[model samples]
Target chain A: MSALFDYTLRLADSALILGHRLSEWIGHAPLLEEELALGNLALDLIGQARALYAYAGAVEGKGRDEDALAYLRDCGQFRNLLLVEQPNGDFAVTIARQLLYSAFAHPFWRDLARSRDATLAAIAAKAEKESAYHLRHAGEWLIRLGDGTAESHRRAQAALDTLWPYVGELFESDAVEEALVNQGIAVDPAALRPEWERSVQAIIAEATLAAPAGTGMQSGGRIGRHSEHLGHLLATMQFLQRAYPGASW
Target chain B: MSAGLRERALAAASGVVDPEIPVLTIADLGVLRAVRLAGDTVEIEITPTYSGCPAMRVIEQELATALRAAGIGKFRIATVLSPAWTTDWLSKEGRRKLAEFGIAPPAGISRRSHFGTDAVACPRCGSAETERISEFGSTACKALYRCRRCAEPFDYFKCH
Candidate 1:
């Protein structure tokens, strides 16, 4: 497989999977305002995924389009980070996961906006703005929940502890990312680590929550190895297309 | 196609109003970016104010219908996501229409991280003493705000 194709698919799959996870909260959010916010955020991610998938399909010179690439791919073929595919445990868990991912995504997309690939740069430029808002939203919630009532603080901290192990995978630079970074087509994930740490730590400090102690890194979403959660997510997400082939709204 | 025909086609397509903010046309909203005509075929390029905006599909359908009604045939509508659409593109006429229709126009260029503490002027009473109720509004492109002066809640077509 082409490195560019793999790299693009990695980005697309992460967005698609995470967007699907967020959409699962559409009607179930803790509050009416949160429902709208999560849904809107999900839409932005899915939109980013759609653009990336379209570009990936074009670059691969495949007959596949966005829908096919999204729905037809099996679990082993998916390249999303394991962090994104994890289930939304509780409101605090969801907030924690989003906080970590968006912190990384903001700078990652910012760097990608300057990519030599025109299409990638354009998508990144747009996505970076959206990711910034998403990070803000998550950060706001982190502070609110952590600094709120005793129960809320405990739950927030618990979620953070559970989700902390996944953060390492985000900054791990593999062969695909290494090659693309050298070619000026991809941002080096390792380089984004410092900024991500500083921003996340600052938010954690304000929230009055202690950062989770570093744990063993669980990696391998870039190579299509994902947690058990992705399988369940794909089953629901791809159900309509699989059940009725070529279905359109 | 003649330049006159192309101009006519562009004028007709420009008349398609944004489905969400009916007070403003796509032209006024700055969503309609370009129109091209070759022979009998026309191509229209539009940018979405927000990435996941549901109004985009409606706008595309309306644009095609408007062009067809004007007797233009073989038209294609393309959505360009680059240089992402900004409220800066909203025309003066669009801002006036938004305020007149009771929706506050965006105050400044949309930034991702900066949720401005700067007060938004109330569209109802022209008071700068407005407070944001929620960052996410009734729609993806808006934020809910209430005027301290008039006590009226309205949607602000957010900078993004």
Candidate 2:
């Protein structure tokens, strides 16, 4: 519908997909400490998702609510980025994805906190703090793996290479960008690219890892289009709500 | 309590502790955001401890029973998911209760902004000799930490 609504849904979808993906690591983290950390982060992401979807529903003024948006929507209607829907692989791969996304998010949301939209800004303010912690955590793992034993280093490098293809889509500016940027309610995703590059480059350098070369991105989540993985994710994440249907215990 | 004093009656419910962390009461944890007396209708705004947290229903039941026991009827506890709950909402007494429960309270409202982090002091030993081995601990509310001086593993209730 409107750009504000689209932007809100996009944010909600990002949190929903990533939150679900992260939850998949509930029992499967490399370390017990990390398991708790990732789960806590997941809780935070899910909380953000609920708040965003609820707000979007409210803003739409058509009485959708969080459940309507989260459970009722089909796969193509979701607007999450591709990286978030990627399955959790090994410790290195998971951390690599976490590192990449958090690396971008650490700055992206920090700047988003300054948005003209008070609610969005408020949400971003809190999210920025949480993301900063997650980035540090993922950064530590990146360093350990990138400089650890031969196999560890190799796996870490490979994770980075595989995840690199999804990085471009995060910075791709689009129609929602035009609406929000024009209304002073958005930050140009492209505008954050320089700073994202500088910070990520430093982290990668510290990890002694090469930036995987890539020219194209697997973009198309922001406009209700997503990868194959998203459908599977939605099936699992939304099953309970779909089945229960108004039985609020 | 007067007919319009239902909220005042519910205010005495400082005994309903968060199920996960049993030491802090619902009131102390600040989850009981508001207990309003709207004529005969009591509307209580509850803030959940976490999203997807299973304890909301439990807390809701506890609240209804507490209100009923306190001679208040026709009460509805509404979940307010906005200004999403933060550790900042935690009362000072709640933090103390957490410490007494063997979980380290947040060092402060400020979160872990970056790495090269130092260990927060141990609640039991009162020594700055603690180490966070894992970011998440037994549950979403805590992080696994160890006290170096005491050589004991404990949970650190993370700042929200």
Candidate 3:
């Protein structure tokens, strides 16, 4: 149960952090259509996070609900990937992040749809379809930016290169996930790497963007270690609850 | 009385139009999954069209309003996610209504349908000669498209 709780929290935290990161673009996205798109994707990720958080709370047999789990947790308590917490630098950087994260998440959710845990399977079934849209949306933009023009290609490539090191942490497998994997309740992140590579490489190749050369991999997010950006993010996201406990509309 | 209450609840719930897509009722959109009567209480189930659809809270309020208006004193609304909602669940009436409202219905083409591979008939001129402008559109469930023949841009409710 503890393993399941930890595994679910990992998924939940990643979704929440990434969703909050994307929500930062609500008023700042370049185009109106793109703005709506990013907002919509944020909404989906947050919704998935809510569901996962609720399940985690249930697994822990605690009184914590989604709100408590999401709003009350400190920065170090978060288990999201380092990739999700990095600043959404620019339009190109945002697209690069989405492309990389969705590339892994799309297949991860799809495979998770068949989990022995019925609740996880059901949530993943819905999330898989949503993530597929994100992957497609991100892939198209990455290709256009990478292949479009000299300036656009340069920015896209630079964004991809900068974000590439964080990708390794997404495929890291640890004991919590390993136990759940043995129980058929969780997926092995390592097994998802090959498929993630295929889709990401294809999109990158089509975009005329070369994959970044090997570099020092970033990890530790899964165990609650995160980038400095997460603290500021949580400060804003949890502000309302911190100021006024149990407040509601 | 139980049977009659169930029927009344169903009627009220079915008549509740989707807040986002006004032309279609919850029933037409398949958001109204099930309605049941437990003695004197009414229970309803609904599913989101998309994981993050914003219109769900409004729909819930509208349902409560409708039930009260129908004189259903005790009722419950539950959301279920086991079988994810899909565009395939959108009824024929809903699709026609969508087209009539100047929005193209789901083209029955999966999102994977590359740029020009699938022909999503334009709602304006019924033209199969259409091009997708953006995979993400005004809403999560839609994609932006342009009719080559009509020279008009429109929203296509892309398949999930």
Candidate 4:
């Protein structure tokens, strides 16, 4: 596969996986308002995944369309971040994961909006708006959970500590990212790290939550080496497609 | 001949109403991008206001039905994601229609304000004393708001 195609899949896969993860909370969110909020964010991510997958299909000059690319792919072929594929432990854990990912995604998409590639730029521009909302939603929840009752604060801190280690992989540059960055078609993930840190730290301070001293970077999702969680996620996500072979609404 | 055919197709497609907000037509919402004749087939392009808008499929199907009813046999609907759809594209007439139907039209283009304090005028009382109940409303494209003056809850078509 071409670097452009690979890079595009990397983007699409992250969105598709995260979208699926959020969709799991549809009927089970803690409250009605939160249900709607998570559902909307999930839909946005899925929509983003569809657009990116469509573009990737065109770039690959392949017959596979968005559905084929999304539903047909196995866990081993998926290219999402390890952070995204991790299970949604609790309300606080989900919020922590979202805060981290959306913090990274907002800046990443903003920088990507200025890319030389028109299609990528357009996608990034649209995604930037959505990611900003996602970041705000997660950030607001982080503050509420962190600054609320003692139990809530304890759970929020624990969630943040558990999720912090996985964040390092987001800024790990690989050959595909390197080539695309050099071509002015992709954002340099490493450059986004500082801004993400500052934004997260500011939110942490406001919430009265201690920032976790992250260690032991876990990587390799870009190359399809995911944690054990991804397989079960794909099992549920790909079930309808696998069962019916050709299903449509 | 094709140019005239395209106009007829556009006219037909304009009749398709938004599934979620049924009062406004797709054209009014600026979802219908273009209708054209490609060889013997009619081609239409539509943009989605939100990425996960459930109405897109319905709109596309409705447009096809409308086109077929207009004596156009072969047509294709393509969704263009570029130049992303924004609330700014909503026509003045569309805004009026939304307000008439008890939904407050978006105040301005959706921008992330740090304060989260956009003054949404209540459609019922036309009062600026409305407060946001939730950032998300019944649908993905709207926000839930309550009018303090009129004591009525309504949906605000969020700017996006």
Which candidate tops DockQ?
4
State the lDDT of candidate 3 residue by residue for A1-249, as single tens digits: 488899999999999999999999988999988998898899999999988999999999889999999999899899999999999998999999999999999889988999999999989999999998888889999999999999999999999989988999988898898888998988888999999999999999999999999778988997777878899999999999999999998
Best by lDDT: 4
TM per candidate comes to 0.96, 0.88, 0.96, 0.96
Listed in order, the DockQ scores are 0.62, 0.41, 0.61, 0.65
Q: How high a TM-score does candidate 4 get?
A: 0.96
On TM-score, the candidate that comes out on top is 1
* lDDT by residue (tens digit), candidate 1, B32-51: 99998766678889987766
Candidates, ranked, DockQ: 4, 1, 3, 2
Give the lDDT of residue B117 in candidate 4: 56
Docking tier of model 2: it is acceptable
Off by over 4 Å in 4: B1-3
- In model 2, the Cα lDDT at residue B104 comes to 85
Native-to-model Cα distance after best TM-score fit, residue A67 in candidate 3, in Å: 1.5
Question: Candidate 3 - CAPRI tier?
Answer: medium
Which digits, one per residue and each the tens of the lDDT, describe model 4 over residues B1-160?
Answer: 8888988998999889999999999999999998887798998999988877889999988998898899998999998878888898999999999999999998977687543757899999899999987787788789889999999999999887
Candidate number that wins on TM-score, 1 or 3: 1
Q: Is candidate 3 or 4 superior in DockQ?
A: 4
Global lDDT scores for all candidate models: 0.89, 0.80, 0.90, 0.91
Q: Model 1: which residue pairs collide?
A: none
